[model samples]
Target: MKKTLRNTILGLTVTALFISGTLCGCGKKAPPIPASRLDFLEIEVAEQEKYIQEAEAKYLEERAKLEAANDSKGVRLLDTMNRERLRNEKQILKKQQKELEKLRQSEANKK
Candidate 1:
């Protein structure tokens, strides 16, 4: 009977130690996810960059074509349209650039 009581006390002491050890912060935390794996904004930024490049290229091509053509009503109309497109595209590019910056800022905040 004495042996049994000793063993029970020993077991309880071991369990208590274990519980206290676990309650004490072990200095272990889940590692932060790798930024490259977590980041989805990069893809969108790249796509927007491509779109901006293509728009600028098309505008330049149209301007060159206009410059080569003799001044006529149709040419004037096309130039006006091209100018509007350029303005609109520039606005879109600026907006997208701002969005890209915001995404970058948010990504940095996660670090």
Candidate 2:
């Protein structure tokens, strides 16, 4: 009788938790950002794009100078460094873009 009672209590507790979880909703949507915040994000993304372009141009110019000097080792080192920098910058840009997109999506959903 004690074993049966324990099993019944466990089952009841599990069912109650399930019902509460379902009612509470697992994925709550975030509130939309304000228009000014959206604008700021847009500006940030644009600045990031510009920065990436400038970095690429600078890298190309430096690479050309190294090639002209015939410093193969220096050229290789520069290539490695520039590639890592660009990769990091691009990742940041991607993150900013994603945030902007999410904000836009939330704003649209709010309407």
Candidate 3:
């Protein structure tokens, strides 16, 4: 019984070491990032910013037009658009709050 227990413990220790060695051996070298890809990412980000600005401008312009119109359909459509904009704004505010909370928690952890 003593021999059997010793063998079992030894086998587990050996198995654990083997697994750790195997895991450590599997770290592969990362490929270098290309300069051209970095440039492409910058260009894409600029384009996206431009597109978002354009979209916001268009929505604001449409909203003003809706507000100016006094017709029933215009009023209904404006109300719908306003509701949607409010909903989207609420979601954005919530997401910003969450990000702020995460930043605060991380800063606290650092301190």
TM-score of each: 0.47, 0.66, 0.37
Lowest lDDT block of 10, candidate 3? 29-38
Off by over 4 Å in 3: 1-70
Clashing pairs in 1: none
Predicted structure 3: lDDT: 0.63
RMSD of 2: 12.8
lDDT (10s digit) by residue, model 2, range 33-69:
4368789899889989999999899999999999999
Q: Judging by lDDT against the true structure, name the best candidate.
A: 2
RMSD (Å) of each candidate, 1 decimal: 19.9, 12.8, 15.7
Report lDDT per candidate: 0.68, 0.86, 0.63
- Candidate 3 lDDT, 1-111, residue by residue in tens: 999999999999877765556434455433334355334444444555565567667767776776777466876776687668757765665555565566557767979
Residue 111 in model 3: lDDT: 90
Question: How far out, in Å, is residue 109 in model 1?
Answer: 1.6
Best by TM-score: 2
**lDDT at position 5, candidate 1:** 100
**Candidate 3, residue 8: lDDT:** 100
